[model samples]
Target: MRTAATILDFQHVTKKFGKTIAVNDVTFQVKEGEVYGLLGPNGAGKTTVIKSIVGHLRPSSGSITISSYDLQKEFADAIDFVGAVVEYPMHYEYMSGYQNLKLTANMYPEVTKARIEEVIELVGLQGRIDEPVRKYSLGMRQRLALAQSILNYPQLLILDEPMNGLDPLGMRDLRNLLRSLAANGMSILVSSHILEEMELMCDRIGIMSHGYMIAERNMDEIHHAQTPVYLVRVNDPEEALKLLSEEYGEQLHAKEAVGGRIEVETTLISASQINRILIKAGIEVQEIHEKKQSLEELYLQLTGGAEIE
Candidate 1:
């Protein structure tokens, strides 16, 4: 049994197409009110997992549960509490945004006009709700897609490539919208190749590659690569670099950085240790501090330089 108080669960799930394995022995849980990320570069089986969870693709083995109901057995009931966008969410281009939502909402008896309006407003498409979908910008279309997913006030939302093709302002707005959804008790799993955005947007991320989940962790755990390295602008960088490379290469990894500064990667030595080391070598320490490990660096480290296809 999954003991993670899960709102969504995938247990030993596997999917195959002829000879190709799209997803293999994958397992993960998304808890309530949390933004979970299914992160990988393209062709990493992220889309397969999302489709399986939403019941669009049945697993070859194991099972799926949504809100504690088995998807295979409960079927409709299990799917009832879920909203999703597998691949790019397709919308009828000729229809008005409101009309498109109405058509989609009619496919399920639980949705009403008020429910549609609520979702439309929530996705920030209310001002343009009556406009034709074809006239909408790419970001607006993305928002409309999100609106379609939320028409039922679903307890769980599964969005694949939720941030695809959005501008800076759109991504920012979408991030805030997702955070707000989690705050109001909605469990969300977003699948995308945009790892940097996912790092900032998701509460925790589950990384998938080569048809399965390779890693999963919170932000702190993912970016724990921060070391005691500082930038130093010295008067004699040539001398400092040679001296440090020759003597302190084991303890202090120093290299020439931009602006004629020396960036050193060192152990958890203190500020005093930095001063003593520089003074002992007759190298004037211009500045010494710490540097936060960016997600891009950590992503490369964790994924082993695997870029999203």
Candidate 2:
């Protein structure tokens, strides 16, 4: 179980670009050892929120605190506990991966050669650490960037679309790495358009739309929030549908699905109960199971089917 200590807090933060409101009164928190996901479609102000958190842009109103240090008042101190890869991981392409890390390590007084080597190994880039970054694959570069971010052993890490150009293997590797980090007590705030990945990675998610936070929910809560829908395949689907409808009435909705299956929608009824009802009514139940709801479906429902970009 994760602790209740809040690692990062955004309280009614708002950011404006002249006449345009990029982020409006958004508030959320990342607890210690939690992986928090920020999800939204294009033009949903996800970038603005990330920027504000990373100090690229200041919130016009409200407050942001990192490890209890106010971002506006104690900029340096608040940022000390943060490590971020916003938008893209920038590096000196001509420099070797080791060299790039060495340069970054120069910024932190306590980062020793042993610490640098440790991070490289931790990121699984030890073998190719001496290679020029220009020759590294996108995944390798991302790993290097992650190594750089954690060189100082920060309490919170923020990533923006860290999976953008990664292949399946790369994505899996990064996902495992993140989960491992979170398990060891690193709080992460990541923004991404990939709903499936977010669903797998985040403990809780805050969804944004049109510059406003529409919803913030734990993964388990989101899953449970879905109305349980069951697909029942029987000898007589039409009869089963009619029997269910007549018996359950407003308690559930039953309809004929493709392939002569009965699609049952209900929150008040269980699959086993429906099966028993059908069997008791002389209907032969061939199969009965609840249809799992995906995070993409939930996201679509919350965003009004907005295209995830």
Give a tens-digit lDDT track for model 1, residues 140-213: 88888898888878899989897777888889888998999899989999988887799889989888877878
- Tens-place lDDT per residue, model 2, 23-141, is 99999999999999999998889889989988999889989999999999999999999999888789899999999999999999999999999999887888999989999988888
TM accuracy, model 1: 0.76
Structural similarity to truth (TM-score) of each candidate: 0.76, 0.79
Off by over 4 Å in 2: 1-3, 222-293
The C-alpha stretches of model 1 lying farther than 4 A from their native spots are: 1-4, 107-112, 220-268, 271-294
Worst 10 residues of 2 by lDDT: 290-299
lDDT, each prediction: 0.83, 0.89
Q: Candidate 1 at 118: error in angstroms? A: 2.9
